[model samples]
Target: MGVAKKSIEEIVQAIGGKENINKASHCVTRLRFSLKDESVVDTETLEEVDLVKGSFSANGQYQVIIGQGTVDKAYKVLLEVTGLQESSKAEVKDEANEKLNPFQKLVKLLGDIFIPILPAIVTAGLLLGLNNILIGEGVFYDGKSVIDVHTQWKGFSEIVNLIANTAFTFLPGLIGWSAVKRFGGSPLLGIVLGLMLIHPNLMNANEALQQDVLPQWDLFGLGVNQIGYQGQVLPVLFAAWLLAFLEKWLRKIVPDSIQLLVVAPVALLVTGFAAFIFIGPVMLTVGTAVTDGVMAIFGNLGGAAGFIYAGINSLLVVTGMHHPFIALDLQLIAAVGMTYLWPVRVMSNIAQGSAALAMMFVTKKKTLKGTALTSSISAFLGVTEPAMFGINIRFKFPFVFAMIGAAFAGMIVAMNNVEGTIGIGGLPAFLNISPNFWSVYFLATVMAIVIPFILTLVYAKVKHKDL
Candidate 1:
């Protein structure tokens, strides 16, 4: 307790004391602080502190890296000693955004809105992967799926398919709920708007394309397509923003006595009409175009696209710009059956893991060896921040070697056109790969792992003998 307290106190002082801290929060493995003055931070001293694994500023927050189990303890002690109430992640993010430029703030806003919805999306992805395994022909048995081999379990496979598809089927609701809350409006209203978009009365989005004439609402001799926004992301996001803006604006002008009765209906009615007429059609086209354009570029570039994306992905992770890609991956999956980006992302992750693993074998320092070993394992499990920020990036050359390995693996992924579901990555990522591409993806993954390990270990030993 005494040791922990001292470490927490030093961390506070090193970041220019408790007075400099505007808001503070913790996420998985780091203490994120929005400070009054970043220039006052003594990063070197903070990194030297016993409990702090490392420290860096990114996403408008000064993040002090600490191991998972220890970060909670440190955060608790920090709040107690500083006499600052523990801030919610959102609150801290808002405070952090005060320091960012307009572009950075916009990116951070998207990250904030989408992150809360990832759990549902990720769970859906895993379940989808499971469904793929069970129903995918030639995956388990030769030319037959588990259900095909055992007709008795056909009902079971059907149920799994139903459950796995729920999130994507009603993605607008998920995005609307999160985006509205992030924009500072009533979440329930956002949900209502989302539900209205995909109401059972409206024609299903997927089925509408097949019909010669879409179901339409005759509004004073004008025809409007009564189509649902199922699986659509951008339209939902825009609708949510408009809903929040309308709700806030209504609340301000409407008399408080009648506000409760008047505001909800007025806001919903206006937004619903606007969404059906303007936002939904326009943003859906925009979203489809964006996804199609991205795929076309990747298809045109083929291996070069993979090489470029994988090579620079680690740098994106470093700057904390990678969060928005989660939304993009999700978008691509919704537009198309699968995303090619995810396979390359997995390759990049394991390459960094392999590089860190290499350091464990070559480094003389016990602390460095331990960090490399554990972080490498973590990276293989799909979380690469520790390995990238803690081990590979810190050493410089290891990161370069990791990128080189990633580029090679990415080329293989692109040439073969490997594709997978979103949100699943690293070694267990094979489960998410399209069943047909499993063998080739595995081969590419092996190269991702081996090439980096060999390169980092060999280069470090030959060039930097001081270690």
Candidate 2:
């Protein structure tokens, strides 16, 4: 038989056909599709198609790994040839209405409530960590030493320092306002709830409760713990949303004569107490349980978890799942008081950066060399996508070596129980280390750089048969 000429339709038909394509999704550099059966697909011919980078199966799904800047075109071509429009349209619609979806709406609400305030929180955490370092070094007398510049700055620095140092002090108020905003409730109500948590009388009551010097509740049966909501999530947000709904419903039923005063008080009182007594505690318990479970896993896995974290993290960055993980880490820090994630992440970034640097060094092709150089710089600055998609994953061997190196180094760091004092990680982490851990921190940072360099060098030599 002579060579067969095939139209796009025929080509698509030969490769499992459009009908066999069950579902499809795209990330930064791949068109991931779920097919009815892998046997129906023609992988060899599909790889030969122009603009196709590579193809593979992962997570029980057939994936066509396109290169950067080509996934959209590939997806469009697939859509046209397959005559599949419904799933694509639904995806678009979902993207558009993501903020309105229940789970997504809550997430968005929480994000909006928390993100604007995150800089302040991170600053507070840094200040606290720095203070600890100072005290440990005998540079400061105590956590509250007025002589400390971090606490005693006269003018502008004083204002900035106050804001940073006082976050935990004012957390309840901040959380309350954010929660109210998130739930479309009265901001004043949130302020009131927050005040109850932070008031001196409440603190005294809490102390009394702790000592068992007083009964759990007064005449109102409101316990001290029930009202102490600071650095807390879930409960306050849920309560605020519940209040918003109740307020609106109550307004609908009240008579126009005394609607303003009567309905408002009743709604606020009912929702506030219910939230304080029931919803707040319930959500607090759930949040605490989640934190405990995560801590347990991390504690159990110890160093080995670092290797798994590093390997999977590189894959996540390559495939665009890394952003969600970043969000989760930030939330974990906020909710759980600290994190063990940054060291592994720092190693992974350095590994990818080193791989890009290696490619720049070895490649004779000017285009590849230039791409690698630029991506390497970006990776150093903590933007790893270009390096990951453009240089590392495209080369394959470098990416694998980078991940392996990262895992090894990350495991070593985790095994030492090394903790990052600062909220940020990656290259910036260098500036954020506590003075007490300076030696360990410096060693970890250097290892992050060195491990990847050596691994990439070895891999490049093995692959190209030349150093």
Candidate 3:
């Protein structure tokens, strides 16, 4: 642990030392610091630290991406070196909140609400990808899917399909529970609100869209539509926020003696009515418009859209703004059959991975080469933070070369109209791609990898000899 300890000390020194660190915490993959002075931090030196995958300032904190299974270790060492005790994530977030702008706060809130639910979504995605293989044409048999060729697997395929779709079908429930928790409300009450939105008594959101008229209840001489929000985003998010706001305010005013008895029912009843009458319809309309607008823009731009998204994806990752796109992917999948953006994102991950790997060969420094090898492999496995922040972005040229490769690959993705379900990125992510387009997608993935690796190596050799 001596070498590891030294590296941790380096991280502390680079971040303007213990004096600058007001508080520190770690999430799944990053060491988040509430710093007294962020400008004093040495970004280049911080990036060069052995265990640091990348570093950036966002959401009112300086975050160092250290990769999973390793960040915890680093965080522990960080605490030891800084002579600071561990702080809860919420505590650290509170420490940093005053530094955030409204927009940054909103992005941070969305990230907090969504990040917890990713494991469930990723599991469903992997299962969905498997189900796609079972039903997809041209994958296992000549001109036919495995289930089509063999009748015995039909029931199994259906079971897989059912399980794979559960998260999406009940997405509002998941979001409601998470969003309410983030908003400082009772999570169980949020779950109840979510269930109320998708109750069997109401018309399913998808089926309701197909009908010209929706069933309604006459309340105070006004018709309130009895429609369910099954796989929606914006509506539930707004509803959850409203529920939390009401619950918290009710607690403050109500006498503590009877607060428990009065709060839950009153909050739920009022929020329920408000959701069905005002919040649901309005936000659903907004969500639909946003999804349609995005699809229309991408559809019109075609290859150009892919080029731009892929080219700038790494930059967005740095700013932590990419978190919203996960919600957008879910919205797109609900509105349309698939999300086109995910495939391009996967290509970007691959390009970052390959570009980092090129440094393993071009650079003579053993520490950098070691970092490049491990981080490259990490990037290829669907996490690019280390590759992007640690190596490529640190060096400058590799980052640009990676983006160039990603742009070309993303163009191919758009030109072919490739689409994929939400899943992990990098090599394993190809499973999420539409099986019909597997051959072409494979070609694009190759270009995403090969172009960056070769270009980075050649550029270093010819242009930057000392690199």
lDDT of 2 at 74: 60
lDDT of 3 by residue, 31-98 (tens): 99999989999998888776777787877888898877788888888888889989987788899999
Local accuracy by lDDT, each model: 0.86, 0.62, 0.89
Best by lDDT: 3
Question: Which residue runs of candidate 1 sit more than 4 Å off their true CA positions?
Answer: 1-6, 9-20, 39-45, 76-88, 206-212
Rate residue 164 of model 2 by lDDT: 52
Report the number of the highest-TM-score candidate.
3
Q: What digit string (tens of lDDT, one per residue) describes model 1 on residues 26-103?
A: 998999999999999987787677776677788789888888877888888898999999899879877787789988
Report the Cα lDDT for residue 284, model 2: 60
In angstroms, the error of model 3 at 326 is 1.1
Give the per-residue Cα lDDT of candidate 2 at 445: 62
Cα misplacement distance, residue 161 of candidate 2 (Å): 5.1
**TM-score per candidate, chains pooled:** 0.93, 0.62, 0.95
- Clash pairs, candidate 3, are none
Clashes of 3: 0
**Tens-digit per-residue lDDT, 1-107, candidate 2:** 11122434444664688787666666667676666667888866775554454465533445565556666666666666677663552353234333244654444
